[model samples]
Target: MNKNIVLKAENINKYFRVPTLFHVLKDISFEIEKGEFVSIMGKSGCGKSTLLYILSTMDTDYNGALFLDGEDLSHKSADQLAFIRNQHIGFIFQFHYLLQEFTVLENVMLPAKKLGIKSLEEIEHDAIEKLRLLGIADQAKKLSMRISGGQKQRVAIARALINKPSIIMGDEPTGNLDSKNSEIVFSILKELSEEEKLSLLVVTHDIDFAKKTNRIIEMEDGRIIS
Candidate 1:
């Protein structure tokens, strides 16, 4: 409930019913404060990604209380959750989910367009600024498919920043990149957290990546082990 806390998850638990019921997460409780860069590390199937989804408001079939920017998310309708996600949370995945046919600027503008709080010209200008912030403004006029993998991911990051979400959530954001590209992305994210006062919660298997974050939450068997 602290004003400085950007996200808080309390007594979170999850289960999957297919092929018999299976417990996926257990009593996960944590808080991320403004401008803090945090990483979650664990083996596959340890529920790090699953937890991210729940925290991101993409998955609602779980028992827990999730708070973002002081608003409780439990029991919210799908549409309400969608608006919350669009307005308060930005997400990046292991893969850049850019539309191949769209130009980089268009891709970055999509989320802000959905929010519909700004005019077209304003959105375009904001998108360009985000691209410039990521050092990819020159690529904005090109189709997403024409860019390199690293460039595409930077476009994704730009897209995620378009709305100035209170927190950015990434699930193995650098998983598909080479070391050079990965380091570039990491530095970009780190700078955003420190300089822009943006909160970041990243789920990564890369030990080196986890080590560089402000804090690391290690998971085992669906529980935070450290």
Candidate 2:
């Protein structure tokens, strides 16, 4: 396993046989290094999410060799992949996706709890710290539905980071936000990547935000373009 290259995918292909067969993703290849922020930009329906899903090991019924930290994950079963993903990767989606019924603190602690961290107090303390880092500590006791969208998304980021994953993947993270909120969201993303040495793969349509990453990969027709 290469210490620097956190993820690398070669010749990835995916298809769906629903309402007829659809070849959603063609052969694709890319590599992402540790602490590197890469933006995946493309038009709508261009298979960017398919690629992200594959990289994150969320969608595994595909053809490719996906290496994470120098280990090939293409052969791992769904359950095994889930374990690695919960510990090593975080995901932020366009929707905040925080459980509306749970308090921010509880939501953030969910992943750690699932990982069998027996010390609930310590885990809650850690979740509180992540909320503080995202400047939403005050909302920790509040339900996700009661907060602003931006705040909710911040909570989502905190939840994603609570496990201290080495990599964070965002799928159009700010697509649902207005300009100011989008800036705030991406700024947090940029800062977190630097401070935590996290490998970030953000899929976005915003050119300005996309260009801020260390590398920007443009996609067309399910293929990465230089």
Model 2, residue 18: what's the lDDT?
A: 85
Q: lDDT score, residue 78, model 1?
A: 100
lDDT of 1 by residue, 145-218 (tens): 99999999999999999999999999999999999999999999999999999999999999999999999999
Pick the lDDT winner: 1
Misplaced by over 4 Å in model 1 are none
Q: What is the lDDT of candidate 2?
A: 0.89
Q: How many steric overlaps are in each model, in order?
A: 0, 1
Model 2 TM: 0.95
In model 2, the Cα lDDT at residue 38 comes to 92
**All candidates: TM-score:** 0.98, 0.95
Error of 2 at 97 (Å): 1.1
Consecutive 10-residue window with the lowest summed lDDT within model 1: 84-93
